[model samples]
Target: MNSATDVEIHAIKQVVATVEHAQRYELVEEFVSLFREDAIWTTAAGRLLIGRDAIAAFTWQVLPGAMKDLVPSYEVVHVLFIRPDVAAAKVRQRYFFPDGEPVTEEGGAPRCT
Candidate 1:
């Protein structure tokens, strides 16, 4: 990985660790930390959730309920720069639910909900 990709991947890893192991409140900040101040996050449903504050609020609302599973495993399939200032990636994640439902695959808003 190039330096930029390495940094972004590292940032993602830190957020994942915080989300899985830290309290929900602690994760709110950690999630935002992975995003740029002017980041534009688009939901898979095509909703435009903009900026850090908006993202943080959105994260706080659904994190505890939908993300209490905490421990999740993801593979970064690809990361390509859209421009010098923009980059995007494709990730696949699997969650091992505590309820013993076996491994579940979830992404986008469904995971957030």
Candidate 2:
């Protein structure tokens, strides 16, 4: 069996934190770096975005429209080592909408490309 190294774990944690903060701050520069050039992001809105340019545009467009109280929380379920530079974590993220309704989801994995 293989496991994630300390550096990889730290990188992943930073990515998660950046995402959590994006709900409350401008994190396009930070969050964009965590992903590969050919990254793909699928939003809960069913929108699929590809490449850094498109993703950056998407980020800029959506950040201001997100719920004011939107909060993202995640749980690390399992980590599999694909390589020293690549790893995947199985996680579930809940987006809490304080003034409206909280959205809870489980199942499905978010792959960091």
- TM-score of model number 2: 0.69
TM-score of each: 0.58, 0.69
Worst 10 residues of 2 by lDDT: 104-113
User: Which candidate comes out best when scored by TM-score?
Assistant: 2
Q: Write the per-residue lDDT of candidate 2 for residues 1-113, one digit (tens) a residue.
A: 32437667776777677776765565667667766889898876678999888888887776675545565566565678787666888766766556535554543322223
User: Candidate 1 has which clashing residue pairs, if any?
Assistant: none
Q: Please give the distance, in angstroms, between residue 86's alpha carbon in candidate 2 and its true position after superposition.
A: 1.9
Model 1 segments beyond 4 Å from truth? 1-26, 44-46, 81-87, 99-113
lDDT of 1 by residue, 45-94 (tens): 57689998887887777556555664455556666777766667666655
lDDT of each: 0.61, 0.66
For each of the candidates, the C-alpha root-mean-square deviation to the true structure, in angstroms, is 4.3, 5.5
Candidate 2 ranges with C-alpha deviation above 4 Å: 1-4, 99-102, 105-113
Error of 1 at 48 (Å): 2.0
